[model samples]
Target: MTIEQAIDSVKKGCKAKFDSTVELHINTNLDVSKPEQTIRVSVVLPKGTGKKVRVGVFASKNVETAAANLSESDIAKISKGELDPKKEFDVIIAEPRFMPKLAAAARVLGPAGLMPSPKSGTVTEDVEKAVEQVKKGKIEIRTEPNAPLIHTVIGKRSFSTADLAANFGEVMAAINQAKPSKAKPDWIKSVYISTTMSPSALVDIPDLA
Candidate 1:
């Protein structure tokens, strides 16, 4: 189907009570067994992800204190488990030096996708900028470790068709830019868009091209 049709289908399929997030799913032709073919990266959507992101920063006290949005007190709260990683924050950003401290909470943060990593731009020297970017709708996109599919939220079902289409275009651009050197020309196999509880609508790859 055309991109506009896919977006319209996603909006129409949302039967959930809350504003369901519109998600983009891409299946690639990469071999999941090969480490070199793995895809992992982040991008800032132009229209934002249409989700409120609570950011947690792991950094030295000095850096936290210096940070404009993240405060030292907040870091302390996270470290002490006062702020539950899963419930309190949607994403976590950390400085390289504080990665060791973050390791201790891996069991709690890892499964929730709240762990900071270099590939996601969450592990950075510039903690303040990272936090700001995340607050402004920076999202990470990665192929599943065991599958060739990549999934990410593009926007909410409440968004207008134009807004969703714009966000969808940004995600496609980022995915194309992230094509691994080892991947073939037809690396991207299929793309779909859907709301949280709706069946997916297939998007025409040629139109996106």
Candidate 2:
């Protein structure tokens, strides 16, 4: 199916009262067995993800003060554990010095995909910048460690076709830029788009190229 068709299908099939997310599932030919083939990157969607992102920052005096000045509520949520990685915070940013503190919560944050990592642009000294980017719709894309599939939310089902299409194009461009040098021509095997609860619609891979 074409990109337009996929977006139309996803929007029409969405039945949720709240704005449901639209996701892109990509299957690549890269071998997951090779550590070098693992793909982890970030991209800012042209249209935001259509969800309010609650960001958490782990930092020392300077960074913490900067973060608190930006959003005191977010800092409180993190310190109070009210922003449970699994349920509250959408993304977590950490300064290098605070990496040790994160070790204590690794068991909880790791599995929820909320753990801050260098590859995901979440582990950095610039805690304030990272939080700002996330609030502005920066999203991380990573291939599953055990599989060649990469899944990420592109936008909301309520977005206009043009907006969704623009976001889709940006994601595809980022993926292409991240292509492994050792990967073959058919690196991207297939692409599919779907709403949070709807069946997926296939997107023409050739068109993406």
Candidate 3:
């Protein structure tokens, strides 16, 4: 769907009330064929979604030192497979050549789908930007268990429906244009959207179609 359609869909399908905080979940085709390719995007809501996400970076000290990328934060550290990957973080980052290192954490991260992958743009020179995105409401998604889950905050309970809809549309476009390819059956199996401490409501992916 184009950006316009995304905006329209969110406006029509939104069910949250005026005094309710909520989020949006989108499922669509994305472009991720090239590791170096930049994912062009814009935040409809200038203030942007507010969600605290953790990032897990796995790299050799040499590799970690080679680049003056992002400063390592508590959330952006090593997460080898031996430990509980899910508990470690939400997103995973690693050197493109060292995907094998992720094998150990596969069992843990795979199920939760936090496995670091070059195809997903986790192997990037702009490590700082990658981490910063997570600091925003950017979500970590995978194609194994489900088609593609794009979770992002819409707004607080105080936001107007139109404001929330615009934010939702931008997130939809981001998810749709994230990877270059579409899922075999479709990019979405199901969708559930909600806020930080609220319950999610089922949203039909067809809204975007």
Give me the candidate number with maximum lDDT.
1
RMSD of 1: 3.3
Residues 1-209, candidate 3, lDDT per residue (tens digit)?
44334334444555656444465655444333533222333343444454345666654443332222222332223343334546756666666555655564456666676666555667665655665655555543333233333555666645555666666665666655654443444745565565544545555566655
Model 1 residue runs over 4 Å out of place are: 61-84
lDDT of 1 by residue, 129-191 (tens): 887788777899988878999999888888889988998888889888988998999888899
What order do you get sorting by lDDT, best first?
1, 2, 3
* Poorly placed runs, candidate 2 (over 4 Å): 61-83
Off by over 4 Å in 3: 1-21, 25-47, 60-82, 141-163, 175-209
Better of 2 and 3 by lDDT: 2
Superposed on all Cα atoms, the candidates' RMSDs to the truth, in angstroms, are: 3.3, 3.9, 8.1
- The residue-level lDDT of candidate 1 at 33 comes to 89
lDDT of 1: 0.82
Report residue 168 deviation for candidate 2 (angstroms). Answer: 0.6
The Cα error of candidate 2 at residue 8, in Å, is 0.8
RMSD of 2: 3.9
- Ranked by lDDT, the better of candidates 1 and 2 is 1
- Model 2, 112-199: lDDT tens digits are 8987799889988878788777877899998997899999988887789999999999999999999888899899999999988888
